[model samples]
Target: MENQVAAASGKLGVLVPGMGAVATTFIAGVEATKKGLAKPIGALTQMSNIRLGKRTENRYPKIKDFVPLASLEQIVFGGWDVYNENVYQAATNAKVLQQTQLDAIKAELEAITPMPAVFDREYVKNLDGQHIKAKDTKWNWALALMEDIKNFKEKNNCERLVMVWCASTEKYIETTDIHETIEAFEAAMQADDDRIAPSMIYAYAAIKMGVPFANGAPNLSCDIPALVDLAKELGVAIAGKDFKTGQTLMKTIVAPGLAARALGVNGWFSSNILGNRDGLVLDDPDNFKTKEVSKLSVLEEIFQPEDNPDLYGELYHKVRINYYPPHGDNKESWDNIDIFGWMGYPMQIKINFLCRDSILAAPIVLDLALFMDLAQRANMSGIQEWLSFYFKSPQTAEGLKPEHDIFKQLIKLQNTLRHMMGEDLITHLGLDYYQDLVESL
Candidate 1:
């Protein structure tokens, strides 16, 4: 099993669908890191270390060293955006990073321009741009996107390609009969069905081209049975529904602790204000519903209210996202958590998280891309539940619950890597040492 994965040999093309704040920040950050101007912080593949054996063996190594992951030097970035701005211009417009950092990698960022994108105004009502693909049926649009993928890979001399959807959330939609099978999906595309979103078309194109796809937004992009089955049939790796950043990231961390300590959560009121293109898209009630569902699912799964009814049965969870232009890419979130402990006495936990949206998401994009590629090389396909560590709504198979606890997610992720490398999976059950001590005594 250790020798099963192919080598990460040549240039890997990272094709993004929406080249806005999150996309631009990711590309620029990678460029800056490659130029030695910055480090790949918050990226587990680049920064975090994995423990291979027991606590005493001291076989700890960076995940990058432990796995055959593509390096920053091997990455070539390109993507499609509704906006025509190059990454440099987009990064400047984003206001996420300092202008000085953008200036440091100006030429590299400017050299990469967005290809025309597949856009549907009906899906994302709050945004419109002129750089959209020519008017065509959804099937034709997917064909055009496949052409884009081919041209990008050939032109960039990429040995492998992976698409990370860094796009805005579309209006809420559910899986209909058309989304039941690839044949139905293709027919719906030919018929130009309104239910087929731009992200789904992009996902179809990428997976059809044998490219691994990762969804970074809370859209039903590759989560439906159609794309999920297609990926497995084609032997391509796919994951996600939304990146677990900022507020949700904190919830996964804190909520797990509360559950572990058996503290009762009565209410959790969450609010956020952001002003990026994402915020703009999410301002629409229809589009916001998609995000709201993604954000709201975190607690129920983590808390398991039905299992512990007395602790969480009466829990109230509310989520709100306000688009404030002055905030730019800075997202400020507040969470008021009401809990109770001994004697059922109530207490409160107020959390205010002022975080850079793209800054947090950029690293997630990198990690997913690298991990998706790694999963491909390792011959893994379909929804990568292990990569759920990076997502808010982890796309699992139907009838399965997603793990929202960040700590458990990390352990699952690390253990997956260990399993990949033929190393012993660390269960953290130290009873073996105690057993040995008792035998010695």
Candidate 2:
């Protein structure tokens, strides 16, 4: 397909729906990175290298150098929040960074304030935000969000904009008749249907405005058929259901390693305790259900019991998230994985990871925003399956099962980038290189 969108240049505004911990950390990290305060360590597009062609070719280039992505300096950050705090205050409240680190970018951080959020008390029962839209109907609230987007774009002088949902997960909502079609969804919004969550309103506004949208939380933001169809129709890139960070990130990494070794996992019990606003929100079972679905899917897709029944068919995977106020945003996860080896000898691998929730999520937010913008510029619409590497439960095209194996997901992501820039997809088939030598001899 011929590329139709203009080349990505000038400033790209990253409009976040939630400007709490992850959002602030992301913006601060970018500012810190720009001022040489910190390096973008986990960002693949910024730090990782891609191997092109045969191993003998010795062609390894940084991924950014290969693709036409927006520079970190060129990325402008703005977003909505339930709290009216600026990025600096939000960062301080989050307590994810050291005082000295925050002080370094104090001025830049203080200047960015969150626009009033379009939030509802029902979806996230644990959170009560005084800073929210007061509109009566969902459609009116959505139009207000569109106005925010336009004003943000004009004020920031951005050539393009992308919205990433870094808000807390909403209550678990199954796809309903309201979510079945664009027309039904529009009518539902107009009628203020009780089933429709606040996040969907934000998503509707973004997709209608032709802005690329990515969901960082596990909320059903852009995942519904209505939004998916709208995205494709509008030709804007969309990705996610959740950000793949912390425990799930580790799960994708370790589960693949276990599968590669053909180890039999009898049970995997994972639990985490965090005290961030996200944790506070998820403390409610309804909200946690949303996160649970996104968290639990990795093992089923990764192990693929149909193919490796003996190794994975009996696997019992359980995930739990607790709200422990003492820990705050520093999420500590304990995973006890029960496995059996060659002779079916039972063994266990226990991991206790003490990770900062927002710190880990910050870079992911940056990568998604940049990559989603790149995907839009490259004219790749619909569900951005290539960016699946960054998501927890990647939204894919209907009828296609998502590839959950991290290595395969990585290859798909990298290959998509290569394909976009007219480069050959690396398949690890080096027969051609050896064939040349054999013929020459």
Best model per TM-score: 1
lDDT per residue, candidate 1, 1-441, as tens digits?
A: 789999999999999999999999999899999989999899999999999888889888999999999999999999999889999999999989999999999999999999999999999889989999999999999999999999999998999999999988999999999999999999999999999999999999999999999999999999999999999999999999899999999999999999999999999999999998989999999999999999999999999999999999999999999999999999999999999999999999999999999999999999999999999999999989999999999999999999999999999999999999999999999899889999999
**Candidate that scores best on lDDT:** 1
Candidate 2 C-alpha lDDT tens digits along 87-193: 99999988988989999999999999989999889999998878887858998999999999999999999999999999889999899999989999999999999
Check candidate 2 and list the clashing pairs: none
Candidate 1 clash pair list: none
C-alpha TM-scores of all predictions? 0.99, 0.97
Candidate 1, residue 402: how far the Cα is off, in Å: 0.5
Worst 10 residues of 2 by lDDT: 1-10
Q: Cα RMSD (Å) between model 2 and the true structure?
A: 1.4
Worst lDDT run of 10 residues, candidate 1, spans 51-60
